[model samples]
Target: MSGDIQPDSHANGHLNGSSERPAPLTVAGVAQRLGVAASTLRTWDRRYGLGPSAHVAGSHRKYSPDDVARLERMRELTLQGVAPADAARAAVAFDPAHPEASPAPSQLVRERAPVERLLVDPLSLAAAAVEPDPRRVKRMVEQEVEDRGVVRAWTGVAGPALEMLAQREKTDLPGVEPESVLRAAFLTAVRDAAVRDDAAHRRADLVLLCADESQRLQAHVVGGGLAEVGVQARVLRAEVVQDPSQVLDVVDRRRAGVLAVFGAVPGAEDLVTAASERGDVAIFLVGDAAPSLWLPHVHRVRTLSAAVEEMAAAISTHV
Candidate 1:
């Protein structure tokens, strides 16, 4: 490798096997460094075939700087709605003068006030849960919602980022209970995003107010993903009254296109019953719902990946 360094650059910036101090970047490393879910890398590897031949440690995965750069480029492409496989190919062939490319990361951040303050700043949400860092989480949620919309912020940013914190804290890592703060921040973002100008050509999007305990958090995530693509999502995270008849009023008042509940939560039967009464709007009871209680209008998403995929497809189909 060349020992020369560019102006204002360190030789240390070069990523490869040349350094003895720093270990080679693994799939997990890149995932963490890039602030994306590990599952996203697996999707790129399996679906787009964007990785090494195999890891030196058999099942382990390693990525060179080129690989990480390609992944970031691919993210820019796919988030713009290009398919993963196509994005992978495009990343390999990106040009400095590429006309189709929108703003660079710097410009995108500078131009969008929200994305700059929340979405781009990596530790904004993480800081919020630490009490000492309340604004961090709130800012992150606000940025994501403002940039991608409420549902998108809820799912893509707040949900996963909170889960990451919970996992970190659960394993006896540093930090306090971030769940409440994160939820509050997400709710704030959702409310603020709801009144934005809607496109005249956009279809009538539904707001799903999740009111079941088990479904509340999952529903919030779903709501966020929905918001990313311009769908409306409201989350009433718990307070689904036992009176199924009265529940109809909440759904109707919100003009909900879909009523979603967390099937894993207790009193899920009541949730299903409430949805059963709503004949017109689609009812989606997420999480593990009993097959016996299944209704035709109800849609169940088993995992985060499944939910993201479903939301993307549904948005494309409808909105």
Candidate 2:
């Protein structure tokens, strides 16, 4: 009976008569198997220490079977709403040889005891700047967005994080390069929140555009925030509309109820003037730019939150 080879009915692959193991998996292979982005795996490795254990000389690091299993547990826990830090701790301690010996997901959840903490507070930015962890910053922003809505997440977390990064950039501190990563994370979170509605339901009630080609990020933030409140807004990136005249065509073609011009770039006054001349669509001017004349159709808002509130009000009136 000991020598007899019984084919495993449950296992995908049969082991040889001898107790041999498969080769270590590459990062790509592990990412594919776990259904996570390769970059995500690297981030977990770099930030959480959930990386490959086997490293050969002059060759890429390879993930052992146990390493992959631990990461898989981490991914599972995170998807189940576990905090990244707690999940990473659990994963690192998990024994792959005896999975049953590891703490159950529910036990892990109970042990961690979920607390509804405001991950991003205005005052917290100061501490975040003092001890910056880019991974933690990205995760907190994303988690806040999921827990709170896009507006709260932006105002409370992402916006402050970006402002801090910008401030740091202005200083003479070297090796502080968090702008690109933080921006990418914030954009991805906002965009994902924006596109949750069905395509047919995304009809344009308001068209959000940058004043010129330089305020695209502001345009997107406004658009995403508007989208969160069920206000369908067509966001025109700066690259798409080079001239103010091009905006007229978009407003005409879309029959947009409102036109929101963000920031005061070059030719913003002309754009506002042209839109006002139409006298058909309500125009919202955002930022510090003062209107040349107080036109009945044009309204100026000081902040993105105010812009969203104005757009929502406009939509309610039209509906």
Best by TM-score: 2
Question: What are the models' TM-scores?
Answer: 0.47, 0.55
Residues 128-176 of candidate 1 have per-residue lDDT tens digits of: 5755456777776665654454544555666666666766645423554
Clashes (N, CA, C under 3 Å) per candidate? 9, 0
Model 2 scores a C-alpha lDDT of: 0.68
Candidate 2 wrong stretches, greater than 4 Å: 1-118, 122-135, 169-176, 198-201, 212-215, 239-242, 290-292
Model 1 misplaced regions, further than 4 Å: 1-128, 144-157, 167-178, 197-205, 251-255, 270-274, 277-279, 289-292, 303-319
- lDDT to native, each model: 0.55, 0.68
